[model samples]
Target: MEVGEMEMRMSTLSGEQGKEKETQSDEDRGYDENMSDSPRESVDSTNETPSKKTQLEDGSHSLSVIKKAVVVLTRLPEYKVSTLRPPTPQQFYSEDESHSSSDSDMQWEPEDNSSDSDFSVTDSKQKTGKPTQNDTKKTPAPQTMSEPAPIIISSAFAYCANEITKVRPDLPEEEVKVGMMVLARKRHMRWQQGKIVEIITRKDGRLKYKVNFVEKGKSLVSGHHIAFDNTPKLEQLYVGARVVVKCQDDKFQSAILAELPTRKNRLRFLVFLDNHVPVYVGLPLLHLVCRPLENSLDDIRDSPHKCFMSRYLRDWPYPHLTQYSAGQSLNAELNGVQQRCEVQEVDSSLIHVVFQDNQHKEWIHRGSIRLEHMTRFLELKEIEDYLDDSD
Candidate 1:
């Protein structure tokens, strides 16, 4: 019975010692029971190391709070950013401006973007339960954009490359018309690219063609714009064509096209006075014959001073000249009666004719001789020969 009494006393002493240790722990925590309602900072014990002398050998004391610690949040990458702001619920189809404009005018509360889970709004704050003062850092917005490649068109159509080959035949027939722009060869002025639109006939046997030039977002220009020209064209000056003869004054009368400068060569061409008579003149010297139009005024022929002739042929300085050969027989205007004559020599300015009836030699001016309208041009020749001709 005495041994049993001693065991009970030992049990009571052990219970009292456990109560004293718990009281000492509560005092060391520095948390009062009444102050439990106030905010309490959480301590991070992750980086704590065991001390050399283990005070927690019995596991009765608490560790001191860490002085410094870093907090990081692992969040999903926002690789697909639809907009700069937080994503909210949006309807795929929207009303017209009438209804949409009125909706924008009304006062509305800010939307709770988090409630809309359709679009996964990845936020760092959501990834981490709540940001503490130690790790309250911001993340950079994502870089996103979708755009198409640029397609720039300077012009709709460029000049025809065939001018050198199809038009000149002197150049290769390779595709060079692309990107090339056709401009007026007129001097002292710049010309835009022109597009041939139509062709109209004149009182004469010449057919007038129309050309158009469209500026960048400007006005429209037609063949009748007065700026358009028919000369230096691609057709009448082609390999072979018949024409009437006339006289013109030019400084290149002596210098050949092959010897002249590049600028002057462009203004030169070959003209046949007759089958045997060949002459070279500046391009401006020759006039392409005009075809009679359906509404042509034939009455203007009788009266040389008519308005149409005056307006069109105002620049015609030389009178029509006729072609003659050395042996051909013809009539002369020396006497009132018709006299039979024999051709002696043919010159550009003068023609020598001898009267067969009287045996009298006379030199007649080119303007005095009457000739037909048949004028011939060189059919074919090596472009190199034409360009390199010295005589």
Candidate 2:
């Protein structure tokens, strides 16, 4: 029993001892927890002041970056700006402007004269760039030709009488007088147109004149003459009178009389043909014609036959006879008998005749058949027809 009791006591003591140890361990755990809570409290306190310390560190870092940027900017050199600016009004006046400015700006003035006001506007406009009325005028173009008028002879001399001188085929009946002036075709420098001093006809049946003042200190002479036979009529002209004359050598043109001749004379010549035959006698050509054997001056005297012969001789134009009536009558009378004569020769004096019969032809001296016989022969029809056929 004793041994069992000892064992039970020892177990109770152990149980009590474990309870005390457990209590002491609980106290020690509480102390260690308190000690651990103090460290956490200290951690919370440090956490509360950490924001201030963090702000101070951030400020120091920002200050350091600003100081670095300031140092970088301060190390660079200063920059210059290159720019252009307009000049002011003061600079414009500073330049030399004598040619651009007026004298009024310098207080200069003209004298107060009336003419000054007239030119003032003109001068002002000229200085201010404007044209005046006179400045706009233009010069005219020049002319290129120069000539004079012509003088006709008729208009120059009008005192001369008009009369027919020498007529032409194409021109009108021209006038002739002592002082008539005419243009000369052959001698242009001679006194073709001049004062007539004297009129004379030559032995060869030509009229000439003594002309005066044709050239320098001298006179001119020409072979040309007037035809008295062809003059218009007695009433148309007279001697010692002023008249317009035509130069025969010219193509028959007329002009006024420049002067008159002091003398005039009739020209004389022997009749070359039979007196019984009428001949055309012009002082210019002195033409003559013989009448046929069968006709007489009585047959042709009052006849235009004289005029016809005159025109024929002077190379003028006139009407022709329809037939040779005298020749025809003579030829009819000797037709069958066959004793007819043919004219063989004709000259200024005589006409030789030859008769041709049935047997043979023979020559006969018909001695200048009287102008009356020639007239009859020319008038015969058969003779005229035979002459025409033979010609």
Candidate 3:
């Protein structure tokens, strides 16, 4: 029992020693803190004791005000603050900065008469370090294309008065002028060259022209069947006139003008051949005689209608192709990409289509969409039944 009491007394002594050591360490920390504050206190005493400092010393400063000052807090390691110092005296009057003052930093003093005092703060972009719009380079204006020269002919020129014009299929009336020359196409005959002497417009905008065909005589016809005469550049393209036409490989070959340019085709000519049978060629394969001499023979054939059908369909856009009507389903180009569309309307300049993707209607130009090139692979009644089946 005596040995157990001695062991308890030893434990009590060790506990007392630990308590003494902790108290000694706390006193030492207080002493070190006082030592660190000594220099600051001396400096504060040397300077004028400001109202803020005196309020802090008295512990009368509010928590919000103390938090905002943050002079001691900024010196902490958490903020990584090294310097909170003001600019040095030498930095304000540096030799290099004083000698080379930039326009951006130019300041006017009361002693300076060179600069005005009414400085603007609105355009101080340099001070704020923001970009200015004036620094960007301006884009140059686009160059315009030159206008086409006017098509003029002397009044003495006889054939220039009534030139041919093509009747646009989209419009009800042919927009033909009184003096414009148009090709008067008959049922199975060669397209007779005619000049519009007078145009009589009906109430519904249908044009009836008194066409004076130089050979077939004067006849009043609707402008629907007439086409503009854009024949090959020839001096005088008569049906039986002997002409030296430009052939393949830039060689001039002898030929006769069979027919002038139609809407479907250009000028067609009967080219003479030495060995093979004479074949009719168009303007691209043959140019009209630029200069013909006195001995120009008048070439004519009894079988002129034999090869006229073959030559006419050579450059036809809808050859073996089906014509598309309204409510017809077809794939067509929308913008630039081809998509499925239903034909809503067809006009000379534009074709209205309803796109399947967006169910939106858009007008496509006649030049872009090939509505004429559809071939009839199946029966027309079968196609109608197929469309019904799809529905």
Candidate 4:
């Protein structure tokens, strides 16, 4: 319901930053801690070694030695039992090469050692001071995201009342997430009213939407493309109509269909001030009314942006007047009297006209000059009558 200023621009959310925010909100607290506890404990227990076990190169160890190690490890404080030893760079590279070589062999083998024996071997392995290879491979930190792209828009005039609205400025793009109501103009079509269902990216690098709206229990619209306009103010938008879309000065050029993706759809229209900078527009009437002398109502209604444009160009009961050109030479005729005038000047109002009657005389006001009488009466007026009266 808020009206946008003429300078507003529409933008949208996209890319990794947007995805991350959505993911963070869906994550459950405590879930990570609960899942990691058991795994941490198992890893710690396996790393424990007994002092009695003699470490060997063949990877074998005695059962009694492992049992003694477990008992001793259990008696120790939890903090002392496990030491976090991260691998050195040289050892990490060596292990990585070894694993890579072994993986290519594609042969699976079962261990002949008992669980107790394996535990002692692991303990002895820990005593040797070698660390896990994973400790060396650090994950790269996440990078900061860049800003979203700006919305592009164009301008056109309204052709009809179906696109008109009293709503004024439309909403902002920040407020227009997926699932908000919007107004759009279809390419080569009338302005349509609809709500957004999803925002999607196209192969052509423009962001578009899957919109949903109903007309009399039937779906009126679905996935549609949108473009921008420069005429309407940012906040006010044409609501509930489809429009023919025009991109360049040539109407023959191809263009995408468009609507407000959300209530916040802001666009730029081309304003011929100095250079072509972006200007915002809302509703069709405001565009026409603001520069009525330069723009016409029919031109707007028929424009590609008309669905939204039409919404502003509402019909009125009264007829408006505009000046029309008249040819040179005022043939003077005054109230059934005719005469030739040497020089003339004239002034006109809605109800009357005043002009010099010729003979280098002063001007006179003609009462109630009707459209039908203008030409005929001009043929029969006297300039001398005004001059004689003045004398």
Candidate 5:
């Protein structure tokens, strides 16, 4: 009877264990049916929590890096920070850098914003792949053509005309008149005595004198090229007379009359210049030096004539010797017109100048050059003073 009861108990326990296993299997099947019904939701639900945690960790890492960069920037100087940053429009397009982009076709727009503007410009450039007017580079404007200043014809002849008129007041009206006996220079010939028969007026209203010479016949001459026929007496210019004569160096030197004028030499006197041999010079080239007291030739020679001659030669009266130098620009007379020239070489009394217009080179007397800047300055100052007076 006891053995039968034990078997019944064992059967009951086994039946209970089977019922629990069936219940666990039914729960697993229901779970699989829910996963199949919304597979994406199940997968997302499983991944969502871990992804959130990972994102939080990544955000913390980025924040730490940004904070570190901010701290480093804060420790740096303002100028250093600015150097690290991109340049502003004004800073980029400065005068010193303007020439760098002069040939570039890109245009630039000025921005008042901070670094954000730079990013926006970069984004725009990347999107369009072309430079716009609002870009960083710019094309400079086309320069305007300016009308040149008027060409001033400042000639040496003009200066001489004014100086000669000041020295001889009668030259302008009395000597240049018609029916005057004057010395006129002929073409390719020496100056000859002539009588002004008629005054001819040109189409340009310039007065020209028609002179009849004894040997050269009739010829037209300019008034300035003619001189009054007031010939000095050759007898009065005695030996040892102090005179000034133009030497081979184109400079007027103090000379002593070694011999009196003779008709055989065409009334030219034999004169001795300082440090030079005796030379025959005509009356036109000889200027006599007058003394207060009359002295004989022997007395004049015994006096301090050498000392006077040395001093006169050393310090010449002409201003051009000291004023002009090589590479200096001035206006000089070429032919009959005034043109711009550069001094190629300067000698004692002559200047070798090259014409700027035609590159023609010629040796000109130092007196023939006129400084354009000086004349222009004088004119401008005079005009300004006149305007001030009028006001």
Candidate 6:
């Protein structure tokens, strides 16, 4: 019995050992499968993590590049960037385009309230701001143009009219018609014969006449300077008188009146010079030298008239005849024509003169020259035209 019991115990022990070995093999197989699966899972997890990290880095780099592009666009000028940019809301749009945009905005309003509110505020601010800026730019231009234009125009007209009046105070204001002959005082204060060309009436109702002066150019003259006739009227005063008459050469010569003036002869007197040269003269040309008694005409005719004239001529108050000097400027008679001359040499009764008009030189009697005071007066009057502006 003991031997059988020992065998059985030994078999049971062996069986227990075999079962334990089987359990170990199963556990080992499971562990080996787990190890293989774990390796594949770990590989997949590592790949996925690295891929996610790379994707995030690529997204961040693209964002940085896009930001740099926006910065570069912002730094460019408006005109250069205009082609690259879309139309802005504040820019001017056609009526149809604005209506369409408004409809689209209305359609999108409920879906995008915050964006719509911001856009509306910006549009309102832009609309209000633009007009004020335009007003500031436009207001000054009209004011600058309108304020001083009339004042300057009126002042200029007044100044010109005043200057004309001051220069020709001797002129008589007369009603004149176009195509009429009149004596007009020139700007140089010289009387000239002119025919009225046109009559200009200003907006202020003032009249200015255009004159075509004889031998001079045309000029605009005021009414004050126009005279239909400027000749002095001759009357029956002192016939048969000895007189000094300004001849055609502008020299004063002694003459004895032979006949009184008559309307048929245009108020001219018949006179005989000391050389017995007969001529007709206007009243203005004659200065009374001496009016002899009515009964002395026969005695004066019988006596030598040349000798009587020479006696009076010697006592004539002509101071400039003795005051001749070299380089003196005077008006003289050359070949019976009045001319401007400069004295080259002087003698007691004769002077060497160089004509200003033709540079011709000649010796002439001192009696042929005009008075010095008349030339000086004319020069001073011309100078007064410029000096009046200072006052």
Q: Say which prediction, candidate 2 or candidate 5, comes out ahead on TM-score.
A: 5
Looking at model 6, residue 322 earns an lDDT score of: 26
For model 4, the local distance difference test gives 0.30
**Ranking of models by TM-score:** 5, 3, 6, 4, 1, 2
lDDT of each: 0.34, 0.29, 0.40, 0.30, 0.46, 0.45
Candidate maximizing lDDT: 5
Question: Which structure is stronger by TM-score: 3 or 5?
Answer: 5
Q: What is the C-alpha RMSD of each candidate to the true structure, in Å?
A: 33.4, 49.4, 29.1, 41.4, 26.8, 36.4
- Candidate 5's C-alpha runs over 4 A off are 1-192, 195-212, 216-283, 286-322, 329-340, 347-350, 356-359, 363-371, 388-391
Residues 236-317, model 6: lDDT tens digits: 2344454556677754555565445433234556565654455677777765422223332332332444443333233222
Quick one: how many clashes does candidate 6 have?
0
Candidate 2 lDDT over 289-309, as tens digits, reads 111112222223323334333
lDDT of 1: 0.34
Q: Which stretches of candidate 3 lie over 4 Å from their true place?
A: 1-175, 188-190, 231-377, 380-391
Identify the leading candidate in terms of TM-score. Answer: 5
lDDT of 3 by residue, 1-391 (tens): 9779857866775676577658756755764565532222112222221111111222453312221111121113422232434567686764433343222321111112122221111222224232233421121122441221111111111132122211111223225678877665443223456788997879998667787886777777754345555444443444433334444444334444433444222334444421112344665554333223232231223243223222222312211212345786766654446677787986432357798999978654332213312211112223545776999
Off by over 4 Å in 2: 1-191, 196-209, 214-391
Q: What is candidate 4's lDDT per residue for 1-391, written digit by digit as tens? A: 2224311311121343355445644443333434532213333345443333333233463323443223111233456545544556776467544443211111111122112111111111122232336532332222431221111111222223423232333354334347565544433333344566676677886555655643422132323323222234434433322222332342211121122322222332212111111122223422211111122223332332333233223311111111222222332345445443322433321112233454344332121122212222221222323554789
Ranking by lDDT: 5, 6, 3, 1, 4, 2
lDDT assessment of candidate 6? 0.45
Q: List TM-scores for all candidates, in order.
A: 0.18, 0.15, 0.21, 0.18, 0.25, 0.20
Instruction: Name the lDDT of candidate 2.
Output: 0.29
Give the alpha carbon lDDT tens digit for every residue of 54-164 in model 1.
Answer: 123234553333333422222223452233346544454332211322111111111221222111112211232322333322321223312211111111011223211
Superposed model 1: Cα runs more than 4 Å off: 1-231, 234-246, 249-284, 287-329, 333-337, 346-391
